[model samples]
Target: MLTTLSRIVKSGWLNFWRNRWLSSSAISIMGLTIFVTTSLLLINVLTNSLVQILRDKIDISVYFNLETTEEQILETRKSLIDLEEVESVEYVSQEEALEKFEEKHQDNQLLMQSIQELDDNPLEASLNIKAGTASQYEQIVDFLNGSQYKEIIDKINYRQNQAVIARLSSITAVLQRSGVVVSIILALMAVLITFNTIRLAIYSSREEINVMKLVGAGHWHIRGPFIVEGAFYGLVAAVIVLIIFYPVLWLLSPKMTAFLPGSDLFYFFRINFWQILLLQIAVGVSLGVASSLVAIRRYLRD
Candidate 1:
């Protein structure tokens, strides 16, 4: 088994380097496929991150009545937290809410003067509720309405902002689905291109392959080398992708962060480095080996 494996691998390696121009052309095509695939993956990642940042910013702010006690708000928070669909329920004291509102309007001299004249905080204490999904906001609102603390509740913005939330959620869903469709179509195109390339390579070797069969070489003995060659194309492409991915990200990230502060794409890439590498390798290797096998079999049949 070891001897046969070594021979197969050796033949594959030789085929790759011996036909240096052909090998380079094959690798270049394979690299294009990898480049497209990786580009799609990165776009998806950035889209998801941006959408999530937007969604997290938009949440249900449940306000308590002016007379509502701190204890009552804390109690409501506990109830919100117990729900399975709730991601988080953050409590903001009335004073803190007032401070935030003022800070936002501080640059408006008229607004600052008006607030100073009021001599009292008009903002109510609140629980900012985020659910596992936008669809679950209604359930959270219902829970708040039915809770024992409902009497102290002032208002929940879920009703007023529902339309905006629904529209954003729909947009996000459409984008995600579109990305998957595009990725799949490109992947199929890549596979076909690779299959045709390997098929041509096999056709070029048909004369040698026929002589081997007459000398009593088995099907696998002829087939194995081509498969290995395909895999090597994938391996080299994957390596090239890795070589270029990080530096490209390093260059692009600062620009992206400048466009969207706290997007932190560089940190995100580092955090998910292993996952990204594995995904690219899986795509490259699978495309390369599968296309090669299919091409060689078709060639043998012909």
Candidate 2:
């Protein structure tokens, strides 16, 4: 078995080397396909991370009337925290809100003058409520409005920002749907390209294959070399893709971070290095093997 395996490997390598242009052509196609698929996967992951970050930044601040006591607000906070969808609820006192406003506007002389003209701090104490998802924000708002503490609540600021949240929700939905459709199409294209490339390679060796069969060569003996050849193409393509992708990501990481503040593309790439490597290898090997199996099946039956 070992001797037969060695011969098959040698024959596959010899065939690949002998037909340099054909092998290179197949490898190039595989490389391009893998590159596109890898890039899409990376983009999808990064987009998801960014969306979560944005969602985290978004929350509904419920301001209470000046007459509302700290104890009443704390009770309201406790109620909000009890909700299943609520991730967190924070109570901001009137004094804390005033301090925050002063800190924010200290650099602006005009804003500072306007604040000084007021007799007292006009800001209200509030509870900032965050939900696990955008969809849950509405439920949080509903809970706040219907609760016994609703009379003390002056305003829910989420209504003011509803338009922005709606737009983001629509955009995320479209992106998710589009990603699935595009991925499916790309996968189909990759499979077809691989199948055709393997078929062409096999056609070139049709006479040799026929001679082997005439000599009563076993199916495994006839199929093993082709499988190995396909795998070789896949492995080479995967390597080429990684070689190109790593540097390309390195070059673009800074630019990507500029557009997406706090996002470190290079860091994310590094973190997912092994997964990406495995994906490339899987794509290459699967394409190569499946294509070869498909092309050889008809001949084997004959």
- Give me the candidate number with maximum TM-score: 2
Per-residue accuracy of model 1 over 46-138 as CA lDDT, tens digit each: 778777877787798988999999998898888779899899988999899988998899899998898889967888999999988777888
Clashes of each: 0, 0
lDDT (Cα, 0-100) at 264 in candidate 1: 69
lDDT of candidate 2 over 1-302, digit per residue (tens):
99999998898888888888999999998887788888788777777777877787788899999899999999998888899999998889999998999999899999889988999778899988888877788888988888899899899999898987777766766777788788889877877877897898888888888899999999988888888889889899999999998899899999988887777778888998988888899989888888888898878888
Clashing pairs in 1: none
